[model samples]
Target: MFLVYVDESGDTGLVNSPSNYFCLSAIVVHESHWQTTLNSVIGFRKELRASYGFKLREEIHCSHFIHKPGDFQRIPKSLRLRLLRDVIDFQASLLNYQIVNMVVNKKNKSLNSDIFSLAWQTLIQRIENTLYHHNFIGSNNATDSALLFVDKTDEIKLRNLTRRMRRYNPVPNSFNLGSGYRMMPTQWVIEDAIHRDSAHSYFI
Candidate 1:
């Protein structure tokens, strides 16, 4: 079995979003390595507290780290930079993982209003390729399945869009992740979207 962790940066709102780009990123990993990866992350958190006297309960948020807010305000700039670097290194150390990222340029005034759907479509296609080629679970096995985990904020809307696309051919005769042409229905994607706190969300 494979687990897909997904997260997005930037707001989907047309008018309120301060940023010009919206990015969606996903990390796919096999079940066997999940515990190792989770432990590595937990270890990193503990190391920060033990070595730097940082708060163990606090999450390392980029905005808070960079801006040095509240408890972070007392951290030295050098230490903050090092923390960021170590976090990046930890992410790079994951083995047998595939990353799928989509960046939407919202500068164009004529861009589609449903930019979120567009980004999701691209990500799903890449995910489909990973599922088809990677036979870690087994070749054409009926039990082949992947679970998608995302933040709770968008669970309802994202699931609605995903199910709609899966049920109907929104883009007929075009590149898509549907099971129309494959034995394994892309519908293998679980409808029950799992959600977690941003702090615990490694994908974010």
Candidate 2:
């Protein structure tokens, strides 16, 4: 089994929104490596605590940290930038993990466009494709399944979207004779996405 953790950046709103893009990112880790990955993360957090006075339980919200909002105001801007770079480096060093990201440019989209749903659909489709082709870790050729853990945002909407996709996901068949799409219902992802508060989940 694979454990997928998902999070989003930027608001879904288009009008008067500060950012023009909304992004969804997922980190995939095999069940066998979950514990090791968690341990590594905890170790990294501990190092942060010891070296920079960053609390272990403190959630690392990039925007808030960068903007020096609330408690983050106490930390130096230069140190925050360094910490962000450390995070990227640590993530890069992790083994048996894959990161998938989907960004929606809302510049061309209508104000009424459902940015959240569109971004999630594209992100989930990419994740499903990755699972289909490379489900297993290492030399194991047997296919594996995955469960998604998304940061709690729009639970009802996201759940409905995931459930619907599992039933009737269609993808364009580029190799077909004409403009055609094929049914590719999600088979490897099990059940609806389990929502978790990002505050509690360090991975989120």
- Tell me, by lDDT, which candidate is best: 2
lDDT of 2 by residue, 1-204 (tens): 888899989889988999999998888888888888899999999999887788999988788887645887777888888888898999999888888889999999997899998998888888778778875453264578788999968989998988999889887887654688989888878888989998899889
TM-score of 1: 0.79
Query: lDDT for every model?
Result: 0.69, 0.86
Alpha-carbon deviation at 172 in model 1, angstroms: 7.8
Candidate 1 Cα outliers beyond 4 Å, as residue runs = 109-112, 135-143, 169-185, 201-204
Estimate TM-scores for all models.
Answer: 0.79, 0.92
RMSD of each: 4.3, 1.8
lDDT of 1 by residue, 65-94 (tens): 787467786778778878878778877875
Q: Candidate 2 — worst ten consecutive residues by lDDT sum?
A: 134-143
